[model samples]
Target: MSELLAPALSGAAAGLGVAMPMGAMSVLLLQEAVRERRPAVAAAAGIAAVDLGYAALATALGPWVAAHVTPAEAWIRLAASAILLTIATRGLLPTRPAPPPTNASPGAGASAGPATELGTEPGPSAGAGPGPGPGSGANAGPSAGPSAGAGAGAGRTFARYVGLTAVNPTTALYFAALTTAQGAALRAGAAGAAFVTGVALASLLWQQALVALGALAGSRISPAARTWTFRLGYGLVAAYAVKIAFPLP
Candidate 1:
């Protein structure tokens, strides 16, 4: 109610404070945006969704969260950290070449590309080209390429970010602190809603800004720079995994 205004500002500040830190999840989203701007945006959306979920829980259900969430927290963090390690390991390994692009356009016949003209196997550009078929327009994405498998992967990617954020004990602690930072205002039902809403909005805005920055940076970088950046991202992610997996006792 009238008490909501000040708490809302505090909530927004808290959301921004938590989200603005550059970390594994943040780097991954940025890297994805730089490498493939469109899909990266979807990943970023997933990040925002998790932020909103956590904010809502902290603001609206803070009174009950410790009882409900604390017991499973350790196991959840371990599982999430393991997943992050696997992803990091995969990134560090030399990437196997994707088989030459296939003409997956419906009913399209085999066509010769630069490779075929030289009596060599067709390369990435062969099947990746547009086909003169119905419904297989330019908007039809390449099959078996970086852009391929995005549909199923999108859900997994979203789930991964959400899981990582949710399992992080610190995220819950941060929210808990924020909940108690104020007194009657946050405890008031309607006033608490305003604070939660502010947190969600700030989180989403920060995430969008990050993705947009990555998208812009991706376009401007050379191939070599992108490669170096990719390696750096992997390294940072691996470091985070290690930290999470072996927390100081």
Candidate 2:
């Protein structure tokens, strides 16, 4: 009983270690949905999938990697920080043409296309919530109508997020450290499985919460607020990357 308890708690704690940064992922996803009118379900799934994969893999391989790979973590952190910094800089760049709608067309069909299919929906109008419309600010660019490549681009966002998460590697290192600390308790197969399961559960719950929150926040915020939100989110994520890259003495 105590054996299982230790691992489960460790796993949950590890999963939640990035609560602040992960919250940024949520905000970014929601902002993407509202401003770009893209569906976030795929992005949310990508984020959760990476989290679960990293947790499980860390639990399984953390001990060996911790022993062998500890020295290179700094390099890994530097590379990841570079990736995050690039992403942040891009966020602060001149806004592109707003992406086409990622949702299904309003009517006339049973099998709705994937919510990520671009150019499949109608143009934004004054009454359309969240999207740039009649009330959009002077600086706010007009949202796009339809384009040939929007689907591929929408899909790429999901893959890019997965790539960014997979390359970070610090989360796995943290998991490995936690598993190393709980060696004896996790020696038992049942206890180890319990810990990994707890981790998966926590990751899933947290990611789902992000998706729900993003969906809810879509219409409530004005376009300017949405723009600043991305700036803040990107900046925060970049800061986290820097912290990972250059830990203080």
Candidate 3:
């Protein structure tokens, strides 16, 4: 019992240590939450799932992974940087044209502006309530209809986060180092399972907290503020990409 408890606690700490850091991944996750387009819960689950997978792999093949992966760290970092840069660029670009001003004549077709340039679902209008009408931003168009909703499903968001988080070489290396140091404790029967469970739970909890924070922020801010927030978030992501591409001494 004590054996299991100790390893589990250690694993939880390790998971939090890795997940709590603010990186490109964190910025994107916050942006997702703020936009309230894709499901944040799904994104959180995806991140935790990737963390769990990496942690398990590291625990199982710590020595082998440490040997091979270390040699490819530079390449992996470069690839991750490239991917992050692409995402940031897409975010910075406008997905669709902005709608005509509110004072436009009745004959004018109001082009629905993208909620944010994240290339996901449309957002509700400023101060709009929960239904369909002129004010129902997301629900106002065929664009946000069944097909769009399906595309924005939890699975897609989950897969997106999994890919985003999995590309970080640091996650794999961090878990590998921990596993190498505590291989014995982490490997001992039920203790190993407990430890992995602890890691998953901690990672999930932290991610969910971020989602909640972003959602709260999304609710309070005006639409323009949300757009600026996304721009800032993506800008930070781009900065991270540059840093990863060429780390300072």
Candidate 4:
């Protein structure tokens, strides 16, 4: 039992070490949440689900994968690195120019204009000019307003999240290596299982916490800030890819 306990602990530690880092998935989740709100949660959930599946596979078939999947590790890392670079570049690109401001202000240069005169029948009163109506202003339209479109936007966000995760070869390789490394401990039976379970649970717990924190922060950040955050996050993910591709060892 004591011997088994060590492996399980080791397995759990390995799981935490690999999963705890704020990698591409983490950055993607944060950006999605901040940009699309509710959809961000769905995207994060999907990523976590994938991680759980990978971890389980690593524990269950560590040996088989290690023996047969010789080129799998290399392939996955290359793919992940490519995707990260693309996403980072997209984020860094300049956004489309904002629409020019309209000159619809009441009586900007009109002589004796009733539109600007106070207490006039055709014009707005002193305090009531061409102000925005209820739920219809510069910040209250379909493009920026809160409406059903938000839900649709969430779906789009989820799709992007799926794309990012699916293309990440590094994640697959990481899992494979992890499982291979912990094989002996896992085969040791119940104790090994317990350790794997502990590690998996810890990873899930930490990732969920990050998702929640990201969602909360997203709610408060401005649109511009969110955009910059997305860029920075993707840039970091790309940096990680470079490191993985050219490790010191």
Candidate 5:
């Protein structure tokens, strides 16, 4: 039992060891969290969930999969490359236009002067414009519409995470090796379950920590800084995708 306990702890640690590295997924998640906080969190959760599933499968069926899935690795790499490229492209492109402002009520004070007057001194009657408030246009720029993209991005991120996990032959192989190495300790059913649980919990904890850190950083930065950071992050993501797609010797 003592021997079993030691191996179980080691196996859990091994799982975390494999996961804690800053891989493409980690970079993407951190960037997304900083750029779109809630969606990033959701995306991280999706990744962790998929990882748990992979770990379980690898633990339970490593030998069978190893024997039968010869070309699975290539497929996974291709899929991951494609997803990464798509995400990178989307990030590089200009953001969608801001949704049209809600029409101001006739008596409502919402109205903005012409674009030329935006930076100028406001006329006394500036409050009498067509929209809801004088500075409505100024406030409703692309930055204000993250909420619009947030939902869609969150869903896309979740799907992408799942796909990446499913197709990453390297991840599959890593789990297989990990589970096999620790299988003797995990032969005891309860110990194995505990080990797997610990790994899943650790992953969740770490990802949540990342999300919190990103949120804090986003909050502290100036809007201009945040915008630039977001652009830089996306650029890195694009570069990462390209690297994956065309690996160096």
Candidate 6:
């Protein structure tokens, strides 16, 4: 138990080391959390899963990946940059308002006859309910709104974050480097299992904390403010894309 505990603790540290840094994925995660907590939670899980997967990959093929993959790091960075740029471009775009329903012509109702002629009045609108209030999930309409789409497609959100996390092969390299540095500590079966578990838990905890914080902030701000905040985050993401595209010497 003690041996496993040590490896687990070491893995936790490694996980935090990789995850605590603020980067493109982190910005998107926070923005998503502000938009919809449920999807954000899914996104967080996706991120953790990828982190653990990469760690496992590194453990299995550390030396080879590190050697062969280093030469193509620039290409990977460019790909990641392009993806971030695309996300920023979409986020910065203004959302178009839904079109209003057309009114019926006076003659259009003639076929149905007047309500008085039928001896019955029209009932209330079907599915009528109170509009969603600010800071509440009520506004998340069935067909539209952030929560509607995001909540409905939580699995998609998870997959998206998984892609986002996986795009940077450097994460695997990082774990590989750790494996080299740690030597036999990661080679043992029980210790390795503990380490992977630790990595998963640590990464998930930090990501979820970010989600909670973003949700709290979103609830406190007005809708306009939230919109502007998201725009600002996307702008930052675009800047990160530029940095990734052109790293300094």
For each candidate in the order shown, give its overall lDDT on alpha carbons.
Answer: 0.65, 0.61, 0.76, 0.58, 0.61, 0.76
Best by TM-score: 3
Instruction: Tell how far residue 94 is off in model 6, in angstroms.
Output: 1.8
Give a tens-digit lDDT track for model 1, residues 1-249: 556687788778978988899878887777666655555666777777776777777776675765566676666667767877877776655222345446565333245444443434222123221111111122435554544455555656567667666667767767866785565567777777787777877887888788899879867875446656767887788888787766533
Query: Per-residue lDDT for 1-249 in model 4, tens only?
Result: 676667656656766776677777777666554443466565765665565566666677766655655556566667667777776666555332334336656566356465334422221112121211111122433356555655665566556666666565555557678767655656555854675666666666666677688768866865456555656776777787786665322
Question: What are the models' TM-scores?
Answer: 0.73, 0.65, 0.81, 0.61, 0.70, 0.78
Estimate, for each residue in 7-59, the C-alpha lDDT of model 3 and write its tens digit: 78988998899999998878887777775534677888999999899888887
Q: lDDT by residue for model 6 over 85-169, one digit each (tens)?
A: 9888876764223243257565665554664244332211111111111223334445655655546568778988999899886
Candidate 5 lDDT over 1-249, as tens digits, reads 564566556656755776688777776667656554666677778777766776777778776666555455555566677777776666545332334446566444234545322333222122211111112123344555755655665677677677766666666677677777765656567766666676677677777777788778866775446545656766776676666664422
- Model 4 C-alpha lDDT versus the unseen true structure: 0.58
State the weakest 10-residue window (summed lDDT) of model 3: 127-136
- Top-down TM-score ranking: 3, 6, 1, 5, 2, 4
Per lDDT, what order, best first? 6, 3, 1, 5, 2, 4
- Candidate 1 shows a clash count of 0
| Tens-digit per-residue lDDT, 171-203, candidate 2 | 667777887776666657787787777776676
Candidate 5: Cα lDDT at 13: 74
Off by over 4 Å in 4: 1-12, 94-96, 99-163, 166-178, 181-184, 188-196, 241-249
Candidate 6 ranges beyond 4 A from true positions:
95-152, 247-249
Candidate 6 has which clashing residue pairs, if any? none
| lDDT score of residue 135 within candidate 4 | 12
Which is the better candidate, 2 or 5, if ranked by TM-score? 5
Q: Which is superior by TM-score, 2 or 3?
A: 3
